[model samples]
Target: MCLDVVSRLIGLHKLFLFNFYPYVQRFLQPHQREVTRLMQFVAQASHELVPPDVLEPVLRALVNNFVTERNSSDAMAMGLNAIRELCSRAPLVMNQDLLQDLVQYKNYREKSVMMAARALLHLYRVNLPTLLHKRDRGRPTEASIELKVKQYGETDAKDYVPGAEALVNDKGKKKTKEPAEPTEDNSDSDSWVDISDNEGDFEIDTDSEDDDDDDVSLTVLNNIIVTDKHISQEVSCVQVLLGKY
Candidate 1:
């Protein structure tokens, strides 16, 4: 093949692998280069770390063909599985910068993929006493919907609902909606998590004689409203990104 053609193919392959390529890239380009690259990685990681052969069919399903829910879920599951497998095989002290980027993906899209986030969090055992902040990352902190208002970050990076940190209440309340609070044990810090905190104030008390389970579920989403003002600077590092979307 000509050098220019090979270079263009390599660039297209990277774009497709990175999920940045649009609809046309797959059909417009061929799989020849990606297949070759996959073979190289399979051989390299096989001897060194990964179960190279165990994942061949998964790659074939993902990159070798087309997109559908089945393919997409397979891709996500494969990516998540690979992340965990490699994390376990690798030494401790996974790179902080790398972890931050990967954890943010399933959040903004409402994929609720905190499973992978938590897997990585526990694998790396990161206990950032404060938030992993980045400045001016290009994501919207506010949403028009009430269900997702609590999703914002204080740092320049996008705020996130950390792995299983949102919606699971540690404390019980008599009110239909549990009171809003940051999930982090940042008692040392004077900060209060305001994500959806204020919007649910009108919720019917769960303990009230007139209230029922259905009412409780209704008011619960109110906690995720636009007017929430629970932001405080004195929060743990990990919880900082947990509240905002």
Candidate 2:
């Protein structure tokens, strides 16, 4: 396919052409087997025709080959992809209206940068679903756990305090009465309980981070809490009221 000609056709026209290419890879859905095959011919025939309107026959021909859900989706994907491809060559910028249209049509809005970003996001949705799952994920520990209090719009003012205390994972443990004294037999295992069952219950996945795999681990995505009030706003709480005689 000539890049120049493909670049000129925009909107619906460009979209139709993209579908006619059958597909760039084996990603061509199975139901679109016939439409995929038919589009190849349409694309070839389209190249020979002088009139741009002649592409309709190819569209009709391509549409005829579809009977399943995959074929239907293939047609939509092709046209949207075509328009999106052509939009890259366009000089003018696209807007929210175009983005809205692409979203409504479930097509790529190549004209708008936002639309392009959204399309890329959709591609991620289809390609990477594991990103939604929460596990033993880890983000960079660089984000200061130190408490910093600041009002809005204040850029220069910053006061750092101590970080949070060590986390205790035992949330459900109950308090028991302290024994008068420790005995020899009970001293062996008095401090702990059998946690074999809970071991598998609280499973944290350190893997399955498709997007963050290269930069950070998923295990780091956690909430940090300040354990001591003194560490936070230690100066703010200062009271200097003295009684006068």
RMSD of each: 19.5, 18.9
What TM-score quantifies how close candidate 2 is to the native fold? 0.21
- Candidate 2's C-alpha runs over 4 A off are 1-73, 85-92, 106-245
Instruction: Determine the backbone clash count of candidate 2.
Output: 11
Q: Model 1, range 45-136, lDDT digits (tens) per residue?
A: 32112233333343333333422233344345444544554444332223456456555544433243446555544443332211233331
The local distance difference test score of each candidate is 0.37, 0.36
Model 1 misplacement above 4 A: 1-73, 106-112, 126-245
The prediction achieving the highest TM-score against the true structure is: 1
lDDT of 2: 0.36
Instruction: State the displacement of the C-alpha of residue 59, model 2, in Å, after optimal TM-score superposition.
Output: 18
Q: What range of 10 consecutive residues in model 1 has the weakest lDDT sum?
A: 146-155
